[model samples]
Target: MEPELFIPARALSKFVYCPRLFHLEQAQGYWRDSEETRLGSHVHRVVDRPGSGLPPLQAIRAEGWRTRSVRLSSAELGVVAVCDVVEGVGDRTCPVEYRRGGPAPGGGPWPSERAQVLLQILLLVRHGYRCDHGCIWYDRVRRRVEVPWTWEAEREVLEALSEARAVAERAEPPPPLKHSNRCPGCALLGVCMPDEINELAGRDPEPPRRLLARDPDRFPCYVTEPGSTVGVRNGRIVVARGRERQLSMRLRDVLHLVLAGPVQLSSQAVHALAEQGSPVVWTSTGGWLKAVAVPVAGKHVELRRRQYTTSPAQGVDFARAIVLGKIRNCRTLLRRNGSLAASDRARLDDAIKRASRAEAVSTLLGVEGSAAAAYFQALPGAFRSDNRLPAPLFEQTGRTRRPPLDPVSCLLSYLYALLVKDLTVACYALGLDPYFGLYHRPRYGRPALVLDLAEEFRPLIADSTALTLINNRQADGGMFEVHPTAVALTRGGRRTVITAYERRLATEAVHPVFGYKLTYRRTLEVQARMFAAYLLDEIPRYTPCTTR
Candidate 1:
């Protein structure tokens, strides 16, 4: 028989606070560090260290002892915990739990904290040690709040464990708490997406709370210089060519490591990055996403199962929504930045209508194709006509890929590739199979799901970034190396485009549906999660991100 699943004592606390949060962290294996969690870890440094072992209850009664970081487990209770501190004296023992922040508003322990300590006390009692009470050491307040064990507290703990176990056994997480004040300070606020999910699910009429922060301080580190090596030294990622140091950045500040072309990363650096949950993305010389090195795949097996088992009709419905959103966003981009002609505008409007009405993926593809043709025909109007560079810089080459025939098409292809890489990483981080998709059929080597997601953002992100580079004169003709067969960006040109792309990602815009502003980078993850919610049937429908 399979052994019973033992719930961690700490997870009990989270389950008490928010069942969905607990489910996301424990069952789904989703975690993102925040300021509050960082501070908590800092405060836990001392008590986290292993200390003197605790003797048996008889020896403890005889000699009164104190131990730090004591590991305890109870098979009967199906619970395990690493108690921070345990003090004993003459047949009495107490578990002391450490908290980074102060006590609750009433100068008492929170319910979650109480439940955690109670479980710890129960574990001690089951192990033949007398534990009547537990103490919570609040580092912020510099005081201890005592929680005396009682029959009622024990019942509460047992009930919470039962509920948490049920939640774990289920394929989907419980619905989020309704407008609770507890969500703001939660470490998994971005992952749980309580407000956004509630609002989207039609359970809440109010707009989503703008709790997610804007652009994060950490940014992607791109290495484009050929023959350069990336390694870790003194907690910093160092890039060097030969014996000369090229760049050094604190490892903490790096979101991920991007290796373009022939860049080399040391194994030690790879191990360090993996430990920190930062993936290493490898791309071809022309920016095609080749592989991603992560410590492990995402743990949400249910979501992937749902993705692979989706019916063709449901797939077409989802694909239609995505295509409609993409076409609408494309029109919005043209109207906002370019001098869209009446004929081209009419064609785009008609295409959007047809795309919305399209029933099959083939029909949707046809509608999207026509819409893109009209959109790109007017895309050149978005460029600056007065720029004194070569006329080829601003010329409209229609939309060419693979071996782009002109500089404009070349830049667009490169930016689209970067966008693909970002979405692919997002898919991996969220535990979705990047190769499986609704709109785009699964193929070897292609991230079909990522491509499907990227369609809507192509105009708003990649195309807009390319336009910014060309119209602002940030990219000149010299950046391109034109060959008879193909056009590619030089190292300097790649750097320039990458900088521009990063800036566009960092730019904040109001989410059309949620009505809260977040960086485009953050929005991508939010959209990915929304897609997951849709697949799990938490939300009625998938809504692609469309900026106004």
Candidate 2:
């Protein structure tokens, strides 16, 4: 039989503290440093410094003592871990652990912390070293609490390790903890969302959903500008413009390959990407979705069943949340970036309230549509009049989707299309049926779920990027070609827009509900997975990504 991979010694502490958090970080690759984590690192620097060797332990010195970080492994326990500190006090070996907090009352360490040191002791005994006692050096109260190895403590640590191994081997995350104070300080809270998941614990566990990875590692690769070509070179996805090599990325790093207009893709490149299960999306010169080259991989058949049957029940609430979020964000953008007429501003404000109070999906949809009309009417006011473009070229009616005759309409249509592409990628990466959704009903080849998910992000990412482009007058009139039936961006125009769009995705903002900083692109993925978790009954309810 193959040997099971070793779990980190610190995982024992985290596993005992919270198994789901441990799984999210270790098993799922979702990590964000927190203040508590930062403080712990700072404290560890004092004790874990290299070449400094062991500091003079007033308690263990003068007795032929040696101390340093020790690594130990045991096949019997099927575990490998590093010991923080080992002390030699005249043939009596002891393991000491450093922590940022104080020891608990009555001279006993916290169960999780105790389990960690016990694991170290067990490993040391297996590694030909005498170990019967250990110590937890709590830095907060500046106290070192002595811990004697007992049968009960040994059993608890062993049982905890077994439980951790079981949890780690599972594909999906375990159930979340019921309301805890520690959730606030948890660095993974934004990704884990325990309260949201546990809220619906009364629902049955949909086992098929277990196939979904809690946090999949799928970053994006963006391409723009004409003459730029993508091809496979030496087992890497290389990008080049004209004859000069622009850059290259490992195929494994990319989840979605976005090829904006005029960007060519080699067949070999497509096959290589397909082998890695990455899709290449094609966009028009105006940034609208033209087509996509997705891999021919089989999906979870039952996932689609859940989407068709279980998803509709949640659609009303999800649609209301999305609509309310869209209106809220639209109002924010207008108040923050644009100068709206008094009446237009009042209409938007009223729309926000109505959308928030909307209980039915139809009511929410009406409120959202009204807000979009009011928002677009006020959008032109946000632009500078001193642009190189002819004043007539910039003039516009309220938002128009097809052909987009006016510059404002043209820019918005393109940007909204790009936003939809991103959300579609997010849904697919999260094992969701992008065509079927809670809010947007499945339409033949329409990707209604993508459209639905895009609603919440339209104002935050797309509209925000468009406003920056127009208000700054970054592109000239020559950048856009006005056709008899449609207006499209020229090569230079597409390049400029893609640059700005990429920048907007890279910009970090504090998540209003979770109180964490992540790029808008990351926020898009986070929100998508939150919805999937809810659909699979992993979380209690879905919360739309709404910014203040």
Candidate 3:
């Protein structure tokens, strides 16, 4: 008889939140990228460093943890999980997590982190160790608090695990959660527009009501009351007093009035006309705030509080750091250069470094043409750089071609696809207008919000996977193809790439910041929150991981 395997309670919770997320994570294996994520990776690396002399699980030792990404398999849950950090604390082995953002005091660990930690505990128990408690270290407050793994927590984790397994066993992605905020934050937001999808499904089809919130500095639109005398009628807005008989008035001509009844104005109607870039006036039966120019923009158009005071100088530094960090990581990954050469590495590095030190995000690239060219040059092959993979990768999904596809092209397309999907999701989740991006700048129909969030992790998540895939030889030319029209991965090609990607993520690597190792999936979420904090100015700058 075989030993009964115990699945970690964490993966289960992830499945509950979004089945597709769990599948991409545990089943198929996908990674996300952004500068925010890179900062998180750098922080975690500091914690997981082994020689720092920090007690096992107390925090990461400076020497770095022997490993950061540790894979554990459980027969009971039919699930395999990767832990962030696992170390011997006294006689008991413990798992310590470093979160990018702080959770609410009574909120416990986030469903995501809790699930990850629970999985670690289960893995230890499988090894005949008694595991009960875990720690969640938050960077914002810079505190590590213990999460008691009680029987109730165990039960919840188990329940979540069962559901996660079921989700991974499926072929296609799961449907979006009903009106969930997560939908907007996902990289797949554009691909899975929940609101539009729901409307099309005839579920929650009617748009929600918009009760106007008060903002005094609004463009004057006509307000009507009873018994007011006629001024002039333009068929748009009319003001009057009612209950007996009332006359219409042109908003521009109306001056003052006496209220005989309730005052009413068309807030939506006014907004619609305003949004058309048309001029409109406002007047009231009682008293009207005169409309001067009939403001072309809506009253809601206000600079973001977070961005309002940020100087170009400061923003430039932040953007520079992000670009340089990405270039640095790319160089680090490429030094071993199975496909991309040392010359290629230097070119890529110089390109991003120049951009980073530039006066602005847009001009950063223009300042150094060589660096810019290098950065663009490296993009095509970064995914299939052939520096970090194993051979004979599995292909369960049949998503890619079988042989001789351009490794560089395939990797590039896949990364673009993921980035596009992620950007779409982030836009919806943040409730920001998608067309605007601080870094990428606003483009017509582009979800700049997605681009902004995704920028912080591109190196850490997507780039890491590409390196792993090519270097390991698990996925190669066989997994991709380029048509005269377009480049894409076949189902088998996709499956092989994803399987290897997941396996690599499950591989343990040491953290330098938190003295732990976390699965790539968990790391992506952590990075997302950290970027949110950065945008909110909770953190001053983003820092990416650098090798000694």
Candidate 4:
């Protein structure tokens, strides 16, 4: 028989507030920290600590006693809880729960908060303690509200427990609360994508609310200097080279840790980044993604189950959407930046039509190849004439990889690597397997899903960044080391390109379907979550982000 699933008392509170949020956290093991959650942790700092101040239940008498972080469980109720604070006097006990925000407008405890306290009291009673009521201390208002115990409250708690268990047993979560105000402040707003999913599912004719922040506060911390040592010190990441300090940054401000070339990262640093949900990406000196160490918490078995069980027809349909978006975006780039001949433009338009009509993955592949060849032939026309470099550098025949044959190819390849790395990190954050993909066939040591998603973004992000670098004279032939067979960027060139690439990611653009502005970096995760929602059948179809 399967082991009993012990629901946490806090989870019951979540269910009472929003069943979909509870399902995302408790069932799928997904979580994202927000300002409110951080403040709540601060409010509970003292109460989160365990102390053996209170005597045992049998020894309790007239003297009042209190204990912090008291652990209790009830197998009969299938519940476990860590009461923030437990106080008792003369055989009567109460659980004291702490809240970061103020009480309800009417100065009463919210139903979810009351349910949490009630469950705690029930657990205490089951463990042979006499508990009559509970308290909720709202730190923000500096007020305490009493939640008196009664049969009705007890019944509500029990019914909520039964409902939560039922929801957990299902393969998919319950529908999101329609047009609810709670979603705006929710910590998982981006992960849940309630409004976006509703819009895509055709249940809502209006556009999705711009709930997600325009840009993340934290950014990637890159250590590119060779022979550097990365270590954690006082909740900060310290980078040094043989006792010479290079840079120091607070751990919270770092989105991920990127170690390129021969840098060494201490175990403590790795553990710290993992705990913060920031992946550690390892890359070669030439910017090739070698490996990644992501947090284990990102593993969501349910989503992976859906991914593995996808039908061939579904896979082909998804692949078509990805390729179609890519070809259209590529054509858009040519029109906006490059001086495309009528024939070249017509060829691209034809490729887009063929891609849309192609039923087989093989046919789509051929269409994509044909489109890429025509697109690259005209790409060089977009570059401005530079006195600092030879014309041959910009006038490349076609896109080249595996030791790019020209400076333009070299820069494009490096930018693509950066793009793939970001997409891989986004996939892991959403609990999706980056190696398994719908369009790109899975291959050993290849991030197929990352490539699959990168298709739509290649022209918009990577190619655009590369073009900006060339047109602005930010990159030139002097920054490249040309051997007989291969061309690569020098260290200085890599730094310049990386800085420009990050700038491009931070630049804002209006989302095509949502009609709201967001940075390229934020859009990556949003698109990834939309794909996840599609896999779980939350949305009827997965729409790729396309540039206008």
Off by over 4 Å in 1: 1-3, 388-397
Comparing 1 and 3 by lDDT, which wins?
A: 1
Predicted candidate 1 versus true structure: per-residue lDDT over 86-191, tens digit per residue: 9988889999999988898889899898889999998888888877899999998899999998888888888888888888878999999988999999988888
What are the TM-scores, per candidate, against the unseen true structure?
0.96, 0.63, 0.37, 0.97
- Candidate 4 local lDDT, residue 474: 74
Candidate 2 regions with alpha-carbon error over 4 angstroms: 1-173, 176-219, 224-228, 241-246, 249-255, 261-278, 290-304, 311-313, 391-395
- Once superposed on the true structure, which residue ranges of model 4 sit more than 4 Å away at CA? 1-3, 390-397
Candidate 2 per-residue C-alpha lDDT over 1-548 given as tens digits, one digit per residue, 9 for 90 to 100: 43476787788788888999888756655555457877998877855753334333344454566556666777778777766677776556888898899877776798788888889888877666667889998999897888788788678788898899888877667887766666767777756766545534553332111111233355667787667999988888899998898878877777778887788899998888887668788886666677766665224343445567774447787787788788778777777865667888799789878866776777776887788777777777777777555433544445666777766667777788878888776665445677876666567878888888888788888888888887787856877887776677777777677778878988888766555566787778778767767666676666777777
Number of clashes in model 1? Answer: 0
lDDT values for all models: 0.87, 0.73, 0.50, 0.87
Flag the better candidate by TM-score, 2 or 4: 4
User: What tens digits encode model 4's per-residue C-alpha lDDT throughout 202-313?
Assistant: 8877778888888888999888999999999999999999989999999999999899999999999988988878899999999889988888745578899999889888
- Measured with C-alpha atoms, the lDDT of residue 383 in candidate 2 is 72
